[model samples]
Each structure stands twice: as structure tokens, then as C-alpha cells.
Target: MSQATKTIQEINERIRKGTAVILTAEEMVDVVRAKGKSAAAREVDVVTTGTFSPMCSSGMLFNFGQEPPLIKASKVWLGNVPCHAGLAAVDAYLGCTEPSEDDPLNKVHPGRFLYGGGHVIEDLLRGKAVRLKCQAYGTDCYPRRELDKSVTLADLKSAELLNPRNCYQSYNVAVNTGSRVIYTYMGPLKPGMRNANYATAGQLSPLFNDPFLRTIGMGTKIWLGGGTGWVIGAGTQHNPKPQRNERGIPLTASGTLMLKGDMKGMSAKWVRGVSILGYGCSLSVGVGIPIPILDEEMAWFTGVSDADITMPVRDYGHDYPNGVNNVLAQPTFEELKSGEIAVNGQKVRTVPLTSYALSLEIAQELKAKIEKGEFLLTEAQDRIPSK
Candidate 1:
């Protein structure tokens, strides 16, 4: 068998045994290219391997000219090893094994667990039950209030802190009426509430459409509501955005609940409630590629022409937005070395040597960790155990 085939087989075996594994950018790129872009894009749900590396000093240049690619394959296997397993069994994959003293790759600390790509793929295949946590805080952003002004669990429920609608309302600005202070929500204020100018339960319509509010109340008895209270101003204008919950649901529960009539301190404006929005928080942002994984086989045929293949070809010329020629003319190592290519106006040779060293270090660490069992598969039973 070819060395590549052997490597793939070994990786698969480790995954079957429930070990952690890491895939090099080169290995990942090869697999994806082999499977075709459309197929690979569809099969791989999340791409997170690049997050750990350093950003490029040269804005337009791809960090590592060519390196291992990280991918969450459509198969369940150990993260530390490469192997062929069905996509359904991927959840068992875990991150690199615990870092050791001598490990240089361990130098970069792992942040929050971002479960997507193969992670999400595994979840879908396994049909896992997910839960979200909800909590409350004051306008000043203090989670817990002072003793005299201490908020209670009962106060939270009574004031509809657990309500989804109220919890998700955006409170960009704080409402202050001399000494009458009102808490602010997370986002922009709702239109009805802003125009009403009065702190009334009826004005809390915007909260009704917030998904953050509904997510926190899923399978729970929580209701969230918040809006700008009446603020006396000489001539201040209040223009609230059209009330539309981004997630298409209120943050509060819509179900009926029994409440005591004599519940005290249940002020509509002062009582801030919070509920679960959903399983995960969604974000919109721009991402950069710190490494480029080129298929050696394809690269060989494409010839050497490194003119910044990392940059999207469409940006170079309008006619070649998806042109095959534009793609082919991309800068290669030969072009870069022969003074035929320039990145961000600077010749490739002018690029700092430290950058290459760092890229090499990153590649070495990733490979070593995979070999040493850094990324492994998590047991499905542990995430969502069978009854």
C-alpha cells in the first residue's frame, strides 16, 4: 500500500480504539481535494483548525505557503489519529491529549470548546439532547445584587426574569429619570417600547419576538421582559429599530403559569429577567486563513507560480471571477523563489524568515500531537447516554 494509504489506515485503526488524533493541513487538504470541493464542503460542517495559529503580518499572504490542513471528516474517529470511520461515529473524537511539559504545541492553550463541523455532524447522526443555561444580572452588569437590594430566585420568576421575551430585548442605553434608574438590555431597544415612553406591560411587545428570550425558557418556566422606562428629556429623540427578533422567537416561555397575587417587588421596569436563548450563540464575523494546504499532486501539475494564490482570484480581475486561468496563474513556490511573484507588493523572498520558522513549528506540533494522541474522540455514551 502507498505510504499515504498506510497512514490513513493507521489513523483509522486508532479512531476505532477510541484515541485522540490530529490531522495535518496537508492530509486534510489532500482528502478534501480528492473528494472534490463540493463533496468535501458538504461533508465537513465546521472548519476550526486554523484558529490556533498566528495571524499573518503580510495581510495578503497566506500564512504558511503550504502546510497540513485541519478538517473534521464526515466520519467518526479519534482526533489524534487519521482513519476511516463512518461520519456518524465522529463525536468520539476529542482534542489533543493533555499537553506535556516538553510539548511545544501545548504552548498554545485551547479556548472554549467549539463543537461544529464533524462535531455537529456527529451530533446529528447520534440524535443528542442539548440543554442551555440561563442566569440573571443587574443593569450595571453585576450578576448578583447587594444584600439590601439582593434579588431572589422567586423575584426572578415573579418579575419574569425567566421570561424569554423580556430576556432578549436589547438594552443599548440605560434609562435614567433623575433617581429613577432603569436597567438596559443587551441589544437595541424595541420600537413600541421606545415610542410609548411609559413603562407598561403592554409596551413590552418587542420582547415577545426575541429568540434569546425563548431559548432561555425552553423546557422551563421562565419569562423575560425589558424596555426603556420613562425618561424626562428636554428634546431628546427616541428612534427604535423595527422590532424583529433575529432568532425568530422570544426569549421567554409562552405557556401559562400560576403566580401569587401578593408577589412584592415585581416592578415591571426594575425587575430584570433572563432566560435561555438557545443551544448556541450565533455570531457574524470575518475569519482569516493562517495556513494554506496545497495538494502536492495538483500543485505539481499546476506548476510553480506563487503570486499570492491565497488571495481570492475574483479580487484580482473582474473577468476571472471564477476563471480557470486565474486559478491556474496563482503564485507558486517556483514563481515566488524566481522573483516572479510578489505578495502585498513585496517580493516573496523579502518575506521574513521568522514567519516560515513559526509555520514549521506549528506544522511539527500538530503532527507530533496527532502521533502522541492529542485530539481524540469523545464517547457518545458520555455526551448523550442511551437509556
Candidate 2:
């Protein structure tokens, strides 16, 4: 194996001299394949990886300035969607899938909403007025029981795009093998694996590019919501001890990211809030990370390809919504991307839930910013544990 270390100074020097090269995670595959990992590592400075997918475990916090008459808000609504308002008066945390209490779906679809937290968030970003309602118990010295107002994103004291979980380290596949279609956060999964929805960016995923927490940790610079952001820490459910290949890459959902960005500075195109028909709301988040080429060993890991990665395709049939009780088939990403795979002795079609086009665009954008010196590489202030 190649040496597994390089100093920040040496990396910066080569970067400034243009001798340091950067490649998209996709491009690194061929570089490592053709020139070998060591040579590629010696020539590369950074590898930009990206993923654009709908993350259900995402939301934002907005601190609307205190309402008049000093109401200690006991309830709140944004575009008819209820938000967590247990904080100070006018403060709320909008969950992406939150639905309106009086949602028409309660009568029609029974468990769905036409406009949800995602729609409300986008409407706020568009400078549209949102109907706000709050109810507070009457109190002496405050003496307010109710308030109805129209609010915009600008009317807030602080609007933080705080997503509890933005990026999953690795995503394998979602399958439906029954005879009936099923609703899922991955969109509707047709029965019999008629389509397979794979969400990761494959070779261009950041965590997959750097499986070990060597360069990516707290305070790592990243492209988030179309602007510069930083990784706060390993997100919820992060399992660094998951199964790995010889290269130490996790074969399942092993790592994740906790991220925060300025809600005002974000673009709707990159950080879109979407509502899937027949399903709930979700955020289509765009994230990009630049992994440092510390040494040939690191570079080899960064260059891992889809062909080398494998994951189990579990049944998303009737039991999926409640639990995953069966494994249908295990296939490499390459096989899935081939548009077909075998499961239960039947050839099934494949699909992708994540947007590769958007992911590729984000990677390119970060690369340009880095090359122009507009974006600087970051050193992790806190390291992620492998255990």
C-alpha cells in the first residue's frame, strides 16, 4: 500500500503551484485504474464528491420576532402546516414532512397533505406571505390568547437551515417484490422490483470517497445549498463500525452528516423542498465535499468504483412500511446501474432516486470555486471515530 500521510503545507504548496490536481470522484476511478493509485495520489490534491437526494430527516428552524401583546405561543402554523413552537414566542422548527392539521387529505387521502412543510419552506424562500396563527393561554402581564398574522422569511429574527441529517454515507437499494405498488420515501416502489431506486451518487459520494474519518470531520468546508457550508459532525445513526471491504469502505449506511447553512443565502434550485404526490414532503439537498489527497493509500480509497461496492436489496413489499423482514437479492451498484438485476430468479429493472445530474453539477461548481481560490480546504476541528 502507498504511504498514508501528507502534510497540509505540502498539499497547499502543490495546490498553489497548480501542480496539485483535483478530480471529481467519477474521474478518479479511471485515474487510479490507468496510472495506478500511487501515481494518481502523487498528482492529485483533492477529489470532489457530491450527492443530491431527497432526505426525509431534514428541516429548518426559524425564530420569528416576538409577536405583539407578548404571546407565549402555545401553537403555530406555516402555510397551514403545524410546526414545533414549544420554544420562545414566534419560534418554530419546521419538520419537512409536517402536514396541516386541517389537511384536506384527512378527508380524502386520509394520511396525506397537498401542501406540507416542504412547500411552506419554499414559499417562504420565494418571499411569499404565509398565514401564521398562534394560540396562547391568557396570562397576566402578557394577556394574549390568540394571534393571526402574515409572515415572510425576512420577518424572522433568525432563520437557520438546520438539517439534523443531510447526507447518508452510503445508500444501497430499495426494492418492491410484491404484486402491488408501495409508497415509500424513495417514491413509489413498483412491485416485483419493476424498478430499483438507488439514491447515492455512487463514485461521487463524499463519505464513500473517504470512508475513514481522515479529512472529513467537524468544520470541513463543503458546498451546501449552493453556498459554502461546514460539516457539524457525524449525523444521527452514524455507524462507523459497519462492514467494509479491504479498502475500508462501508458496504452499508455507515456514516452521515449533520449540517447547517444560512437559509437566506440558499438557492431553491439546490436546496429544494419537494412534495411527492401520494407521499409526504422531503428536502432535495445538494451536498459536495472535497477530500484531500493526503497520500496514495487515501487516493486509492477515494478512487473506489461502483463495481467494487455491493449492498443487499431487501424486500420492500408489504412488510417494508412496518419492517424489513427479508432480503431479496444482493447486487453491486454496477449491476443495478446496468438497468437490470436478478432477484428471486427473476430479472428486475432498476432505477435511481437521487439526481446524478444535479450531483455532477454540484461537483463541478465546487471544483471551479476551489480552482479559483474562492474556496479553501478545511481541516477537521473534530474527528469522527471509526469504532
Candidate 3:
């Protein structure tokens, strides 16, 4: 047996009428614990989840207005970072981790990235002036060979944040078991399993709350980088078949999302550039998703707590670099959040790469918007495939 079932339309109507009962994923855990899933499903209309982490697969797509000579750009650069100009005459895409040509990469100091595409994107969005240089081979129709100009985000015809993969349901915890320290995308790892690093909001993660991809799919509305965005489709390397618990939560890296949003509506606070010592540069993005409690099962899924979310630990010094998928151990988020985790009978200090406080703020902000009728639930057009 089940409680009364609600639809996206019904939730939207309640939101519009200012009668919607919205709660953050963290809050839903307590509500479901006290009242059970069935009662919570009938009482709660929406549950908001959020995550703030560095996503290397993010980038910006820009359509720069044409110049007078109508040059067809074959090579493009924003600031010092190279941008992909294969789409159209003036359209270009800037990848987040694309290092600058003059970055002095490893020449002077190893792994110290001074600037990159991620920084350039952040500069433009912050209303700072940026230099745009293009190179083109002379043609009969378009004769201009070289062009240079200064521009800002407001000067571009269009700027869109297009991420191929983000919001990983569960990611690997990185540790170093070798002799020397190793620098990785997971940050610097000390030798002899001295420290460990992990990234995720645990129970507050968007995909973790919707573990089965039932409500989060193509055309699903989400809060991305402080702006309303959409889940375009299944992201690259979206593995939904990973090992899971009875609650459907994955124990390792699993389901991912391809997100897109307009840069004009985004905020600098949520979209920022980051430089990793001994690694490279990447973009830190904030994403939030609102789940409509359509049934009792959905409510139960959203009530999952950090104590139930587990992550696989991997040795970054050797196994991870050599493409070995060997997992050291699986630890729950509750133990990881305790500031330490036991590996090989020794207590190792643990640190989080993602910001849980900020993630909670995003969830609370999203809940407030839904309660005020500023946001509404969207019916997913298609579900992401499992295979």
C-alpha cells in the first residue's frame, strides 16, 4: 500500500499557491525518521539537494560577434588559454583544464599552474576585461588573417556554461601508499597513507537523492552555478550499474549528469576558478536539484543520510595512475566526516575537497525559492539509460 500520489503538476500548483511544503535533503532525513516515509511523502512536496565541487569537464561556449573583415577563426585564444574554434566562424568553446600556451607549465615550478581556461572564464564573468586573439588563414571571401580585441562577458553574443560531466553520485577516496608524496587531481597525497581526500555532499548530493534516475533526467530543471539550468542528458562515463546498497546508493563513482545553463544568470560565488598545487587548474561549480516527492518510495530515497552513503578508497600513488580499479576499502560518509578514517588498522586524517556548508546553503536557497513560487518542478522528458 502507498499514500496519495502527487504529480509534477500538482506540486507546481501548490508552489504557485504558496502552500508547498519544501525541505532540504538534510531536513528530509529528520522528517522521514520521525514520521516515516509514507507520512513524509504526503506532507512534503519537494526536497532540495546540492553539491559544490571541482568538475574538470566543465567549459564555456561563446559566440563572439563577427568582425568587419568577417574572418573565419581557425585558432582562438582567450587571455592566454586556447579555445576550440571548430564549430563556426566566431563560435568557440573554452575547456576548464586547458592550460595557457605561456603558462610556463612545469618549466620553472612543477605543477604550478598560473592561469588557464578556467581562470579566463571566471575573469570574463566577473566583468573584468579580457583579451581575445584569433588567427585565420586568408581566404577569398574572408581575407583577415589575424585579429585581436578586448572583450567582456557582456560583449559576447552568447555565453553558456556547458558541462559534459558533473554531479558524480559517488567518487573514489584518494590515498597514497607509496614512499614519496604524489600530486593528483584529488590534491596532494602524502606517503604511507598519511592523509586521504574525498569530494561529495554525501546525502545532500543531487544524484544520491535520486539514485535511480527516476525524476532526474533530460529536461529536468536544476540550480546550476546559482542559475536555473537543465540536465541535458546522461553525462560522459555515466555508469549506473555500479555496486549499490539496498537503498540504491552507489558505493563508488557512478551516475553523472550533463548540465547546461546561461552564464548571464549565474553568480560568481558559485562559479569559480581553482588552481591545484602540483596538478593543474579547474572550475569549482555549485549545483542543486529539486526532487518532487511523487510517491512514498521517492520520499524514502530522499531520506537517505550520510551514514548510509559509502565510498570506495583507492591508492592514487599507484593503482589509480596505472588504471587499476582496485578498491582498498569502502567507508561510510559518517566515518569520513568524523575527520579521520581507518586504513590498514591505522587512523588517517581525512579532508573533504567539496564544501558541505556551501552545499547546504545552496539547498536552503533552492528550498526558499520553491516555497516562494520562484521555482517549479519539471517533468523529465526522458530517463537516463542504465546500460
Candidate No. with top TM-score: 3
Return the lDDT, model 2, position 83: 85
Candidate 2 backbone collisions, by pair: none
Error of 2 at 106 (Å): 5.3
lDDT of each residue in 1-387, candidate 2, tens digit only: 455667666766766766667788888999999999888878888888888888877777888776557777788887778889888766789988887677776558865556678777777777888998878886775578887889888887877777777778776578886798877777778876787777788778788788887888999888987877788998888887887878786767778888887788777787777766667777788899998988887888888998977766777675566775455667887887788888878887888878887898888888877787677787899998765
- The sequence of per-residue lDDT tens digits that candidate 3 reaches over residues 1-387 is 245499899999999999999999999999999999989999999999999999999999999888788888999999878999998888999999988878876568866887888888889879998899999987888788998999999999999999999999899999999999998899999999999999999989998898998889999999999999999999999996988898889878999999999998988899988888889999999999999999999999999999989999999999998999998988999999999998878789999999999999999999999988899889999999753
RMSD (CA, Å), candidate 3 to true, equals: 1.4
**Shift of residue 266 alpha carbon in model 1, Å:** 44
lDDT of 1 by residue, 74-180 (tens): 32222122222222211122112111222233234332123322222122223332221112222332323211122222322221111101111211111111222
TM-score of each: 0.21, 0.92, 0.98
Q: Which candidate, 2 or 3, has the higher lDDT?
A: 3
Off by over 4 Å in 1: 1-12, 15-329, 337-354, 377-387
lDDT of 2 at 358: 86
Best first by lDDT, ranked: 3, 2, 1
lDDT of each: 0.22, 0.79, 0.92
**How far does residue 152 in candidate 3 sit from its true spot (Å)?**
0.3
Q: Sort all candidates by TM-score, best to worst.
A: 3, 2, 1
